[model samples]
Target: MHLKIRHRTEYRYETPVRYSIQELRLTPPQVEGQCVDQWKVSTPIKASTSHDVFGNLCSVFAQESAYTSMMIEAEGEVHTQDAYEFIDAPKAVSPYHLLQQTNLTEPSAEMLEFFAASLPQKNTIEEVLKLAKAVQEAILYFPGQTNFATTAAQSFIMKSGVCQDHAHIMLGLCRASGIPARYVSGYFFAEESPNLASHAWIDFCLDIDKGIWISVDITHACLIDARHIRLAIGRDYYSAAPVKGVRSGGGGEALSASISIAKII
Candidate 1:
């Protein structure tokens, strides 16, 4: 399957920004299960500077205008490729591990207990699938209840959250169980679905002899397919935000974004 994507983000500031620096992780990497035939990003505002942490950036400073718009348009052809063998991406080498090490906090005792019980028993793919499904059934998908900063234990205790929360809870459990897991930020298409939104999920390294990192979307209760377009992978949302930045300005700021995607038949 092939896909084409268009994403646009606009910013209107109440006060003129003296200077701003931003990091973008919008470009999708060509991975084992996906092939990028062609890709490009166009920004209306010429970037003062940019580099690849994974995406493009447009750094601006001292704009005289009070309102500004930053637009990024990307078009690409991506094909579904065959799955690769799952390799042991330990915490030491795994990107997620590196992220966790930098940000340390205490894990809940209840979460630790759950990890102890779940990891040892999940020796087969079927067992892992069952656990993921259980999480889906146990949690309700409510958007406004949780934000990107919400953690796994909190979501588990609340029994409700958006996709990010679900992914975090699931990823934490998998990692605590000694399985290598990472967060996936992506987009999903459901034929003619009007309410398209950014999606999140988890990819866990399989224990089978072949070694595969199978993706499990607890929110959808299914394996990711052609409609899925990956942006970045990390421990959680902070590392994978489509756009992150810092501005040298005081006063309130607001942001708005719009994304559009079309599939070629």
Candidate 2:
């Protein structure tokens, strides 16, 4: 399948920002079954591109001058295979590195006990999807109830969150079970609504020595299909966030992001 995608983020500040720098993981990588045909990023200033430790294509840009607003946009075309799982090549970071829990993915003691028996003994697709099903059932998909900083434990206690929360919960459980799982941040082409375009999922390593992984969309309770476009992946959301930045003087900022995915015939 071929897809055209555009993502735009805008920030308006009540006060001028004297200096700001942004790190973007918006560019998708050409993995086993995914190919990045063409891609471009638009920013207020020239951006430098490089790869991060996780092997994600990243771009960095800085604005030194005072500014009241800023915009960053990434647009691209990609072709993907219909397969749900693929063997990713080895990276600078070992799959074992993902087993380390981050603040966002650390599970509560209650969560660990709740999923203790259900955690997959073998990292098989069938067994993992069962875990995904249990996660989706346990956590209702309710937006606005949680934010990016929400932890897996918090969301599990609340019993509701969006796709990010679902992915984090899955990550926490999988790692606790001694499975290597990474957070996948990407675009999911939904025929139903544009609001669902921005999505999150998980890929648990089946054979770490061979870099084999099964990608699962916990929110949907299924393996990733062609509709899923790969982006940056990391231990948790903070590492894989499409846009992350710091500013010296921006105050009371209003931020908006838009994502669009269209399937090409």
lDDT of 1 by residue, 105-130 (tens): 12467755654544437645666667
Q: Give the number of the best model, judged by TM-score.
A: 2
- Error (Å) of candidate 1 at residue 263 is 1.9
Clash statistics: count for each candidate = 3, 0
**Cα-based RMSD of the predictions, in order?**
4.4, 1.2
What is the per-residue lDDT of model 2 for residues 1-265, given as tens digits with 9 covering 90 to 100? 8989999999999999999999999988887668999999999999998988888888999899999999999999999877666676555578889899999999999998888777998878888999999999999999899999999999999999999999999999999989999999999988796887999999999988888788999999999988888898899999999999999997899999999888999
Query: Which candidate comes out best when scored by lDDT?
Result: 2
Q: Which pairs clash (backbone N, Cα, C closer than 3 Å) in model 2?
A: none
List candidate 2 segments past 4 Å from native.
none
TM-scores of all models?
Answer: 0.78, 0.96
Report the Cα lDDT for candidate 1. Answer: 0.63
Off by over 4 Å in 1: 44-67, 81-92, 95-107, 111-120, 192-196, 207-212
